[model samples]
Target: MKGLLPPPGAVRLLSIGGLVRTTGFGIMTSISVLYFTRSVGLSAAQVGIGLTIAGGCGIAASVISGRVADAVGARNTAITLVLIQSLAVCGYAFVTSFTGFVIAVSVVLSCHSAAEAARGALVAGLIPAEGRVRARAYLHSVTNAGLSIGAVSGGVALQADTQGVYVGLILACGALFASSGLLYMLLPQVEPVAAPSGRGSWEVWRDRPFLLFAGLNAILAANDTVLVVVLPIWIAQQTEAPLAVFSVVLIFNTLMVVLFQVRASKTTSDIPGGARAMRRSGVLFAVCFALWAFASGQPAWLAVVALLAGAVVHTLGELLWGAGAWTLAYEMAPDHAQGQYQGVFTMSTQLETMVMPVAGTMLILPAGSLGWLLFALLLLVAGLAAPAVARRHTNRHTNRQGTPSWN
Candidate 1:
């Protein structure tokens, strides 16, 4: 029984490291805009530009870091990146000018992206294949719990509005990262699983079917953005649900993830299973969106019922989609280049976040119910297309046995 799980020591270290790192980040996130606007005296536009640039650089760094992980080792690379990230995060407290802010942001984001990529690869190396998705699911739950704690702590700082609190939180986050870096250093090193054919990172780009899979993943990942950016606005403008329902919806989503994410992952052990899960999630999303569409102009009580129903359905879709996407991303990557593949896979999320807010708003907010209907239709198409895409990749790559493992 013990042999079926990851080493207890390794699991403990990883869990602790994630807890500290996420909690610290969460503390800053809730008030980051306030810090940039009030403390740093940056205009809203400047802050947006800085963040956009930072995000772009971070996504690129993730892919590049994969190459580094393959050449060196995932554990060593993750540890180094975390240490550098900690230093860069500390530097954020000192920046006064726009240029300084941009530079600091770039450095912090680059290091953070690279560290995340290496960490994912390291975990894949450490945990047995059978337990990998479950391990990731557990980590995801820990992250949400840590985020809730951080958000509450940050909200307190926001309320205090004192310079010391602001500076202290920033420095404290850096110190936490440093602690995580030290913990990562203590973990046993995992060797890079080089490609059997010695394929380069370029091969990943050349794989058209895999590229399509990643692109589709990015599109589907926009579900997260929709929940964050669109749901609140839609509830206010289109639905008669009470304003307080927005907060309820947020709690519902987080609680659902924390409770059911592991259970969902258990359904998806391989790529085919993952694709099927994702497709089913897409169908659920389409149904949920359709329900949301009908909430527009409904009576208050009816709207509340409809919105609540939609939220439950939406949460189910999210749980399944997240589990399937994580499994697909891990299983479809070449074992030897897991870091690079995972990094490339993460680009879908980056791209989704970068594009979805404006696009989704434009799509759903303008035409009202018609907009939601259109959006739902798009998801339906994507859902139906996912399985066919996976099958195509499987057929193409399975011949020589160099194909990425679906199992």
Candidate 2:
């Protein structure tokens, strides 16, 4: 409240709703895989395949729904999607077979994915252009805080390990979504800005520069998966440190995002500044992962030390990357096509999360030290590439408008 967030209004309402939605999502994420395998009797392969296909379908839904948002209004579209998300998530409780599970997964994934883009469009429409990045950062901070809360609740339920606990968690997630949807409905809808006449999703597809930028951003987004999927395996199998140390890594990451994301966004509030931040973030990630590689094969004490230190460094990279990404996303999109653009950008995240687990684990965990060093090199390349890419977009904007657009 005392920091950089926009004052209480649409921004705050959206943030609160986002918080509730994310909390629900966090709870589901913590146990969903386990529930599918244990309670529903699905094999791991089936679960993975189901989720992957669902995510792929969600990408298409995201692209299409952006146009729907632009037509129906972002606020209204977001509310409908969230409400549908609630019903879909609740439906998970009744799924007794793989087919039912896949259907439920598809509905939840697509609705949530589309809802996020629509909500972003709503923010772009309602908040002043200059304040959009801060508002986004503030919402992200709320997301991190809510995730922490949900994770703790989920952990308790997991420890209890009762059918009732699992059902309760699933139902609670649905309730949270419903509540968020209601809150979304209460928020004022901004007047729609029509896309240039005759333009539609095809125009979005033809935006080569934005597509390239989104692809690059997706590569950078892999850094997020590295913190979650890759690190635990590395610690459990490759290092002598207690697995409990992994909890510290998660706590550190969450705390950093909650406390510093807004402050970090302030420094990268413009496109050029965000480009710089992205460059710096790459170096930070490279160093952090390099440190993680060093932690391997060390004694338990040394491994813990390295892991903790690397987590702190990794969190720095995460903060910078997140801040810069948010700024660039808002800055690059056209005023009238924010929904479509945001949808396209959201696909980058979807792609990263879907692909990064296999790439990071197979690529980084096998070769050990060399793998990590190579991974760092990849980050460095992406980091170096971002500034130039951003500059090109800026130059193109200047050429079209007779001045830089982000300013």
Candidate 3:
């Protein structure tokens, strides 16, 4: 366990910081749709559109943040973003109209996105390469745990009337950002890696392996978004189960991450098999979708059982794939351009959020089964293709550098 983990102090600090950020993020995300659609009186389609717009803004902010971090230093960049996030949450409380809400949400989302990029760059700066995967896993575990706690607390606060609900939630988010900002301030100053002479974001995009990973990740992210949005709607439509069932499933997922991620991370961290890990994860996700397809036709009780099983499997895949993905990002990135690489990786996920709703909506329409089948096929392709791409890139780099193939 010790070997798999980051140093105890770094782990402790990162965990606490993750806890604060994820708590705020969980509370906000869990309620944003409700707040916008129900409390603020927007239509469902409008809410979706708003989210898409905010996600787009977030993508832009993430890229800009990475560049700013490279220019001004990661810690300073992080602190600035954190402050912006805090103010944005407070702005959420004042959004009385749809236009105001959209603007406010966009601001908040952009700041949150920038903060996330900064956080990733900060992690890359602080942890050694060998310890990075485990560090990311541990950080994710703490985040999941914090999110579980925050979800419950937010539920309680949201049970109050609309005004009270938004007020309470925003206050909680603001406090968390403030706490994260303090933690960022206290972190030991990590010197920025000097930028390479000719590298830029466009050059990073030209790397074939990186592009392949990003493309596959975008697909996986689309599916993940479906699970968040479409699945819940499907469950509500088909089952007598309470809406809280989704929350319970999420709680179970978070619990598994908190309990097992460290151990699972340890086994895989030093394996030098990023591509294989990704393929396995894609297979597992395909299985999850397969289960979901079957469960869609089941009786309510049977559906619940199937959903639970699928959730467990999917969460395990997430743990494995997430660790591998971060490790690959860290490894593939040149030391001098870590921020740019990390930003691009983060951008793929954010891009997924933007694409998911439109794609999921199209799939669930007249040709729903086709949608599922297409999704399954895409995952299988990603599973097969990632490793092949990785090997090809590895061979190319080795040849260019005159290094041993195994290294």
Each prediction's Cα lDDT score? 0.81, 0.85, 0.74
Alpha-carbon TM-score of each model against the true structure: 0.94, 0.94, 0.89
Write model 2 residue lDDT over 1-407, tens digit each, in one string.
Answer: 48845478988898889889999998988888988888888999999999998988888888777777777789989999999999999898898999999999999999989998888888898989888888888888998988878877788789877667888899999999999999988788766786777776556677766777787778778888888999899999999999999998998888888888888888886777778888888899999989899999899999999999999988998888887887778888888888888888788867877788888878888888898889888887887777788878777775454453333
lDDT at residue 208 of model 3 (Cα atoms): 82
Which 10 consecutive positions of candidate 3 have the poorest summed lDDT? Answer: 398-407
Residue 185 accuracy (lDDT) in model 2: 82
Candidate 3: residue 119 Cα off by (Å): 1.3
Taking all chains together, the TM-score of candidate 3 against the true structure is 0.89
| lDDT measured at residue 75 in model 1 versus the true structure, 0 to 100 | 92
Among all windows of 10 consecutive residues in model 2, the one with the lowest summed lDDT is 398-407
Instruction: Supply the TM-score for candidate 2.
Output: 0.94
Candidate 1: worst-modelled 10 consecutive residues by lDDT: 1-10
lDDT of model 2 at position 132: 89
Better of 1 and 2 by lDDT: 2
